[model samples]
Target: MSGYCGASALNRFVNDLLFFRNRLPLHVAEFSSYGGDNFDEAVQYLELWIRYSLSCPVAKLSVTSHDKYQRWLLPKGLITSEHLTALQLTRVKTQDDLDFSSCVSLKHLKMTDCGIYCDRIMSPSLKRLMIAQCHFIGYARTQIYASNLILLLLVDCMGMTPLLVSMPYLVEAFIRLGYCNDFCKHSYEIGDCGDESCWGCQFYEDNYGNNNCILLHGLSSCTNLELTAATAPFIFRKDLTRCPVFSKLKTLLLNEWCITNNLGALICFLQHSPVLEKLIIQFEPPEIHERLVEIGGSYDLRKQSLVLKDLNVEVRCDDGDERVHKVLDVLGSYGLSPEKFKIQRPPKLTRARFDDTWTSGSFSFEQEI
Candidate 1:
């Protein structure tokens, strides 16, 4: 398997997985984007990979097709439209949709900037999902319902939440809501075009990062959850739940400044997610609040059920008294031995921003917190 014949043989090996796969595995699985006078040749390549490579034990899908990349621009029937001008996509074809239902054994799916969740798709074997800057994602029933699935990320999908897919048993989910201020134009461009048919900014905005809000609604259902956000404003209302859930969660991350009574949120967290063991509190510069030592001597967590094992902290500067000891007092009260603490004053903050009206002094902690 050397040149073009090697590619062809690999394609054949991948196209029909039932044809004795698990031999020497073809390392890279790619979706060709060559939209020429002869488009069938490319579809043959995609169909082969989607059909074959996915059948193995350690399947890898790095979807970068002209179709997959631009799947966001194509509507229900317009992907195959004969009228070329009617579409905003660069490649036009009769290629059938590529899904992962057959790839139930897949462990890794990397679709960066793709048109995913367009159908009732699921990857029961998926363990990793990485999606970057993509377009419209049609709401599939459940793109990932696998119990084995872990680690999933969606970045820069400016306009839509193409990620409403729910996983009942995920252990780690890291999501950043919203996008760069520059990409805001892309959101407005793909807006709903039907004023007479009922469409507006909000309707169209429902497509990208806005849809990441789906994670909030799906959180209570995720008992085995450990998630981190770069300061998302999705403060779930009281009716959402009195206590936050993460019963099996062991590690929590904070990339920027985190402000609260610190204890109030902890009260709610311990009230529900009792099994938590490791808590990481990271702070950015200027507001690192210094590091908490044995502040206020010690304070109790109020709820006595929490048994946290570790508190690994990274602070930007060693400056303020308000920052350090307050948190230490909170942990000391929780019965955490001093030897279990892993604290680092980084002297600099990571490039992240957080907005806590309670912490920023716009509102008083006694009032809001």
Candidate 2:
């Protein structure tokens, strides 16, 4: 189980499982492979084990492949399993036809450091889904349709950001769009960069013109949400133009991406969320130096109304820093009193100059106000 076993040993193990008459109801089955000299043989053994485990109707299944260079293509039977309630995978590659709709009993699913070569993930019984550090290996944007999902964590994933279908039952979601996203580097600030040949630009225009709510629409039902993006990802800013009202949202957290466009995106969310109570903004200092893009003309804060019970601003800079004051000025413009919000700075790193490389701690409002 730790390392590669000889071919005879592997065959004997598989033969034992295959011929065993009294296969007890399998509650959990886990397999980890370090890989070996023969890749095809290893795959064959893996397939046999997976087939045996599925035949046993495993309730929870986990598979981890240590080989970074080569990944096992998940068996089609695993996706259609009815007894699997919890499934975890790492370094596994999924095919383009990967669909979880057939998994009627599946609830909790997690994938890490895996290769996702699929265009869509449709499931009905899934409740909690987490996909972190996974590489989405395709040119088209991946679409996720988990209508019954409650908790979602799609963090630090590399590739084009996946389009989320409506999740009406969702309660909390943590989506962190990394720098490697498709349009993260492209500037949609000046309205589409009219390059017909550029795929990013063309995709941006197609989505914008069609008023596609790529992410926000699916997350509209969540009560607590954290949306963090590196530097300047255009998805969040672009969605703000046709922003959905967060009717159920109470606690919301955002990073520098919201304020990159002259606080227009921030103000847009404020106007949309009528019931939002707590707002946390993790201020990134380096964004202050970047040139701001103009989105949907200038924001008129006076026309909008915001009533928040709490607002916490976590910044790496000192309290007297201009960056902090600039944020305060924007909040003040929206009729937010000083007592409603507090400036939070980490104790050990107070007053330390931070660059684009600095990453803040977990997004929480637990710090002393």
Candidate 3:
């Protein structure tokens, strides 16, 4: 709110807040804080106003919270503990920013950049739990069975120990390794822990450590994923188990910019999907932009079940890079024949380049690799 922290923002802001279940939506979408330290105060004001607006409300329940953690907490101090439905507690520094105990109706929950602990399990209706950059002390344990549960995202949660999650209904789960505060980037808590043991833990593990083989096999019910591997993970092999949904992943992106999967994993990925239609490989070479135009161009997409008509490979290049000749040569060497495969040169990196919609949707050679 500092950018528009004035009273004017609050004038119309009062109506912007929405609540569900017994919980309230505090931080709409942002998962981290930039400059504001006291946005909680503004949030608190909104909640009180929402309560007042409830009396006149007839059909629609337009509940509100001013984002005040303590003010909303009662002698019982269990705000989210009742009537609460959807909770959006993002970038909140305070523990009490969300009264979890009072949020009895919570179904969709999102949180980041705060210390969270749940000694007792929460709402049975709670389905979606999106959290990141937060720590939970006392080893909080809550046994909740959400058959309607959909998404559970935990990023940079360096604290959580990998637990055998039992959410069979979970549809989408996204996790990445990096500094918790930044959300998109991960620096090494144990950056080079990947001697051999720490493989899947960072990207596939429930927590932020290298995952075990068991965890790799348990995707719960997650169908859609957007995982960024800070390192090569080998906790689970494709031969060990078959993930039909993931193997034929509708949309997939592998950012080996900082780390590259082993040759085995890379080859397995090439052959893993029979249904993979779009693939984006972000090749980030440290000192030089090593244009891997050769490898990606000449891939055996057919062996992986991706026929020429079904495959679209995009080898992203940093600007000012020269043409790639060998990478394409390599694909043609093996079974990933270069039938109709072209060095897809994407248009100049624009806002469009950032979109997962188009890049992951179409299979066209708009430019060179």
Estimate the TM-score of every prediction.
Answer: 0.50, 0.83, 0.50
- What is the per-residue lDDT of model 1 for residues 117-216, given as tens digits with 9 covering 90 to 100? 3433355566655544544332222233444555555544544343345465565554454432212222222212234333332343343222333454
Model 3, span 1-369: residue lDDT tens: 456665446545444543223343432222122233364444444444435333222112322223424222211242323444555544333333233444456676665554554432244466666656555532322223344556655555543323323455665555454432211122222122343444332343324212322232334344454444443322222211222234425544554422222233344454545565655655554354331111111222243442335566555555543322333444444445555354443344322111122222232212222
Top model by TM-score, which number?
Answer: 2
- Per-residue CA lDDT of model 2 for 96-123, tens digit only, reads 6557777789898888888888877888
Off by over 4 Å in 3: 1-83, 93-105, 117-128, 135-147, 156-158, 161-173, 180-223, 230-248, 257-262, 269-274, 288-311, 319-334, 339-369
Relative to the unseen true structure, what is the C-alpha lDDT of residue 152 in candidate 3, on a scale of 0 to 100? 53
Q: All models: lDDT?
A: 0.40, 0.70, 0.40
Candidate number with the higher lDDT (2 or 3): 2
Question: What is the number of backbone collisions in each predicted candidate, taken in the order shown?
Answer: 12, 0, 46
Model 3 lDDT on a 0 to 1 scale: 0.40
Best by lDDT: 2
lDDT at position 89, candidate 1: 18
